[model samples]
Target: MKINFSSKTKILLYFSVALILGFSIINTVSFFYIKSYIDKNLSKDVEIFKRIYMYEDQSKLIPYLKIVDSNQNINQNDIVGKVDGKYIVVDKGKVYTELIHFIISISLWEIFILFIILIIANHLVQITIDKEKELKGILEVFILALTHKIKNFLGIQRVNIEILKINFNEKALMRLEKAYMLMEKDFEILIQALKSLREFRDKREEIDLKTVLEEIIKELESIYPEKSIFIKLSSFKVKADRTDVKNIFFVILENAFKYSEKRIFITDSMEKNIYTIKVLNDISFQEKGSGVGLEIAKFLANKYNWEIFNQSSDDEYIVYIKIPKK
Candidate 1:
């Protein structure tokens, strides 16, 4: 049996490998660079010290002292702390341990800071690449669907135009007009989708959840004036792309408003790090009609790593959206 891994699983595997390789390369580079740096500039007086003073390069100590031999190839201006570490330098036939100590103090700190920065940069770059890949997937699916829709509409429009031109009857004209209206509606939907995508680009900020919901509710109320709606939402601050969050809740709330028989009730609560929203409404139809709006909401939720699902019974429909309080 062939096991088809999910996109998310594949992304995770790639991300893990990238992180491991990135850290391993950084570590290997740091080790070699530090070793080479010490060899060229810091590890020059170890043999001299061991040969002259019988002081082990890895086990020796001193204060602010300087020792000069008659045939000295090492010079010590000043030594701070312990001198047991294998840090030695030879310059102009002068053994300099103090300079080696200072070099270690400075170089190690610099390397550590650079290492941390690289790790952070690597993680951020990986996250950005992964998100872009996901977006590309969404765009590909959308374009394919859009192309199919355009072909279908164009085929129907062409046939209808030919019929009207040949027959010139009331029925043919009505059919052609209906096709035009449907095409216009599709264009409107396309425009809205494009607008949403444009608005959602790189716009991350703190959003007042209740405030945004109220705005969506106002807009939806204008569309469904006859529908009685009630809301009891928490004033939680959520950090996300504001337009994305708006689109998610807008679709769910609008879906509720569009299908309700009499009244719609919306409420929110927070548990742990998850904010849960519930939209309940009396169903006017048993079938719940087409679920395009809910499907869109679910897609947006899944894209952002949130949770959204629905439940329906004989009398009512309920949509639940779980968002993280980040």
Candidate 2:
């Protein structure tokens, strides 16, 4: 069997174990030390009582002694005598023994309560750290995605400009305009993505899955017209932030286009409030590209409680996304 614990749980477990061990050690040492101290005092008192009984002071000791049942058996360390029609008994260490037990019980209770409070404090601290880490990761991914998108647009603009310089035709001008439009659209998407990242709560609304997939496909077709693409999608509704859904689709589709051999296939279906999208493409295993986009996609999927699965063969790659409907 395997057991997994979160950071908070693990920390609490470790601290609790240490605390219990520490308290146990302290209690054990204190108990023995107290017992030894009481025993020493008890022996001395017994000696003093014996001297008084043997010599000059049974009457003086009567006031300090306690009356016990005559039938009670006295230990060798206890002192007993008859004084004014009552049997007086002086215990060697019974009082101190009870005091020790009472102190230990109270100490154990205090330690148990303190352990609970410390565990709660540790859990709260762990929660704060996790939230900060999540925010930092999202910010880092946003910056990297923005940089990658800008660089790609710049490269496209540079190519179109070079073509214009060489040919200076209406065709070149049209291509430049198209490139500018794409850059503008990408800039808008980037803004939306950043906004989505900043939101701390889900802003879910009904979204048409078919429309989102079509938009992604159209965008990719514009960028790589030569790449053959096929889509088999059913009309379905999902509840999620529009920008988040669009970004997830865009990231995966963009990667598919970037690495696919010559064709991309997309299929989707909806059943029992769950929508599954599968993307399959032919690509060699040796041609694996940088996985930054997929990483970002996976992160976003986790945030939205969606599932993503990837499988690759010698010459084919496939990705599946399972998202719940609102």
Stretches off by above 4 angstroms in model 1 are 1-129, 140-201, 286-289
Writing each residue's lDDT as its tens digit, candidate 1 over 11-67 gives 666766675676567656766676566556433344444444454332344221234
Residue 91 error, candidate 1, Å: 26
Clashes of each: 6, 0
Residues 98-213, candidate 2: write the lDDT tens digits. 76676768697968887787868797878777788888988898788768767766776787789888978786677667667666765776788777667776788988988998
